[model samples]
Target: MSDLLRLLPWSGPDGRRCYVSADSGGGPVSRLADRLEELQLDTGAELLDHVEELLRAHRVSGDELRFCVHRLAEALRDALRVAESRGRRIPVPEDEMEDEMEGHPEPPGLC
Candidate 1:
């Protein structure tokens, strides 16, 4: 959907990052990748809630903390990837760039 390079939601067979070419983003693979991104984000959110509740308990063991940390790391990686994929698709407004070019980065004292 963007002219910029697009990163897909999955890795390659060798565990390398995967990318897709610019297109209308309506292909079956694209659709599946989008769905996977949604699921990844949902899982990350659920992990966050579980971490909060688990931390609230007073009797956390080293093993429990280790497992939670491992899972949290995974969720964080998914969230970062999703953020990067979505961020690349965001278009910069032409007018905003024009305003910056004119040296009026922000109107008067609205910094």
Candidate 2:
């Protein structure tokens, strides 16, 4: 029985904040949140890959390029929010190891 509330990463459909009342951050709801955050990170990685390809191919028009960039920005924001919520640094997914290793420090447990 605790009187503390935990912040969730996402807002409600109506754009309102949400909170969960949990004694510990290891319950079913917390597990679900972890899964969701991982998914969001993965999706952001995918979006980044797609955006890179699109930029290299030079196939998108002015408006389409703008839209793609917007989506990419949103994806980055979502991934960052997930990392913040989990109190961890933004984890570069395995598929991006080559790019990350170029100039960034290795993520935890990778060395």
lDDT of 1 by residue, 4-79 (tens): 4567777887777777653747777778889999999999899889889988997889998999999989988988
TM-score of each: 0.77, 0.64
Q: lDDT of candidate 2?
A: 0.68
The clash count for each model shown is 0, 0
Stretches off by above 4 angstroms in model 2 are: 1-5, 88-111
Off by over 4 Å in 1: 1-3, 93-111
Ten-residue region with minimum lDDT total, candidate 1: 102-111
Candidate that scores best on lDDT: 1
* Candidate 2, 5-87: lDDT as tens digits: 45566777777655565455788877777788788888888988888888899778899789888888888888777656555
